[model samples]
Target: MKIALLGAESTGKSQLALALSAHLRNSGLAVHHVGEYLREWCDTHQRTPTQDEQHHIVQTQIARVMATPADTVVIADTTPLMTAVYSQLLFNDHSHDDLALVHQALFDVTLLTGLDLAWVSDGLQRDGPHVREPVDQKVRHMLSQANLPYQVVYGSGPQRLENALFCMGRQAPQWAKQLARQESPTRWSGLCETCGNGDCEHRLFTGLLVP
Candidate 1:
C-alpha cells in the first residue's frame, strides 16, 4: 500500500512518518518510509527552492516512490497537493495547474495530517501573504472537494503519531496481509546489517495482522 502523509509546514508530518515507521518496526512490520522531497531538492540545488521548484520536487519524489517494488509499502512524507498549497499561500502563485498530473498520480490513500495541530513558525519562515490557519482550512476544503479519502490526525507529539497510525492501520489493505507472508523474515527488524546502518530501516511487515 502507498500512503502519503501531508500537511502544512511545521505540522509534524516528518516526525509522524518517522515515528510511524519506528512504531511499526517495533511491532515487527516491514515498512519503507520516504522522507520529504523538498528537503532533498534543496540539498541538491544548494539553496532554498522557489514555490514552483518545490512543486516539481514533490512531484518527482512521488513518481520515484510509486515506481518502487510492489512488495514495499511506501509512506511518503508529503504530496504534490501540499506543494501547490504552500506555493499558492506563500508565493501568491496559483500553480494549481502544475499539480494536475500529480493529483492523478496519487494512490488510493492520502492521509491529511494537520487539522487540529497548532502551526509552528520555524524552519522556512513565511511572512507577508502567508496566513496559516486560513490556508490550512483551505487545503482541507480542496482535499474534500477532490473527493479524496482522508482523515485528520490531531494532538501533540506521540498522540498525533498514534492517531495517524491508527487511522492508517485501519485502512490497511487485505492484499498487504498476503504480502506480509512473502516478505523476508529478516526485513522486519528495521536494520541493514550489510552497511551496518539503521537509516533505511524496514517497518512495513511488522504488524500486518494486528490492530
Candidate 2:
C-alpha cells in the first residue's frame, strides 16, 4: 500500500508517518517511510523555496516515492499535492496541480492530518498558524475536485496513531487486525488472503516478508 499523508505545517504529518511506518514494520511488513522533501530543502537553503522552485520541490517529492522499492509499503510524510497547494496559496500558481494530482492517483490510501493540533512555529518551514486553515482548505478542495478518497486523521500522540489505524482498518481490515494484535505468527496468511493486495500476497509467497 502506498499511503500518502497530507496537511499543513505543524499538523503532525512527519510524526504520524514515522509512527505508522514503525507500527507496520513491527507487524512484519516491509515498509518505506518517505520524509517531506520540502522540509529538507528549506533546512538546507535556510529559506522557503520561491515560486519558481515549487515545481522542483513537487517533482522531487514524487521522485522519492517513485524510487521506493515496489514490494514495500510506502508511507509518505507529504506528497507533491502539498507543494501544489502551497504553490496556489503562496504564489497563486496552479501549474503544479495537474502533475501532483496525476501522481497522487497511484496511492492506495491518503490520510489528511487535521488542524486540531496546536500550531507551533518552525523556523523557515512554517508560515504561521494563520496559513494553516487556508492551506487545509486548499488541500481539501483540490482532493475533492480530483475525486480522490482521503481519510482525515485527528488527535495527538498515541490517540492520533489509533485514529489513523482505525481509518486504515476500514480500508484493509485483515491487515489492520494483524497490526493491532501484534501476535499470532499465522496472521500474515490471513492478512495476505483477505487484504486483496497482490504485492502483499507476492511478498508473502516469496518469503520477503519483513519482521
Candidate 3:
C-alpha cells in the first residue's frame, strides 16, 4: 500500500508517517517511509527554495517515492502535490499542478492531516499558524478539482494515529475502538455529513465497533 500524507505545516504529517510506518512494521509488513524532500532541501540550503526551484523539488519528492521497493508499503510524508500547492501559494505558479496531480493519483491512500493540530514554527520550513488554514483550503480545493479521494485525519497524539489507521481500513487497537465508541455520535455526524462519502462513513463507524 502506498500511503500519501498531505496537509499544511505543523499538522503532524511527519509524526503520523513515522507512527504508521512503525505500526505496520510491527504487524510484519515491509514499510518504506519517504520523508519530505523539500524540508531536507531547505535545511541543506539554509532557506526556502525559489519559484524556479519548485520543479526540481517536485521531481525529487516524487522520484524518491517512485524509487521505493515495490514489496514494501510506501508511506510518503509529503508528495509532489504539496510542492505544487506551495508553488501556487507562494509563487503563484500553476505549471507544476498537472504533473503533481498525475503522480499523486497513483497513491493507494491519500490522508489529509486535519487542522485540529496546533501549528508549530519550524525554522525556515514553516510559514506560520496564519497560513495553515489557507494552505488547508488550497489542498482541499486542488484534490477536489482533481477528483481525488482522500480521508481527513483528525485527533491528537495516539487518537490521531487510530483515526488514520481506521481511514485505511486497518484495525486500530481495542482501546482506541472503545474510546471511539464512547465519543458522542454527534461529533462524527457532522464530519460524516460534511464528507458525504459512504466509504468514509463506513470506516469512521467501523473503527468504533468491536470485530
Task: Indicate which candidate wins on TM-score.
Answer: 2
Residue 114 miss distance in model 3 (angstroms):
0.6
> What is candidate 3's lDDT per residue for 37-139, written digit by digit as tens?
9999988999999999999999999889999998888999899999988898898899999999999889888888877666788899988999888898899
lDDT of each: 0.60, 0.82, 0.81
Q: Candidate 3 regions off by >4 Å?
A: 170-211
User: How would you encode candidate 1's per-residue C-alpha lDDT over 102-125 as one tens digit per residue?
Assistant: 553456556665434455655443
Best by lDDT: 2
Residue 201 accuracy (lDDT) in model 3: 53
In candidate 2, what are the lDDT values of residues 1-211, reduced to their tens digit? 7999999999999899999999889879999999999989988999899999998998888899999999999999899999999888878899999999999999888888876678998899888999998998899889889999877776677777877876787766665666666543222222233232337446544653455
Off by over 4 Å in 1: 43-47, 51-55, 96-105, 115-118, 125-130, 173-211
Worst 10 residues of 3 by lDDT: 187-196
What C-alpha lDDT, on a 0 to 100 scale, does residue 152 get in candidate 1? 57
Q: Estimate each model's TM-score.
A: 0.68, 0.83, 0.82
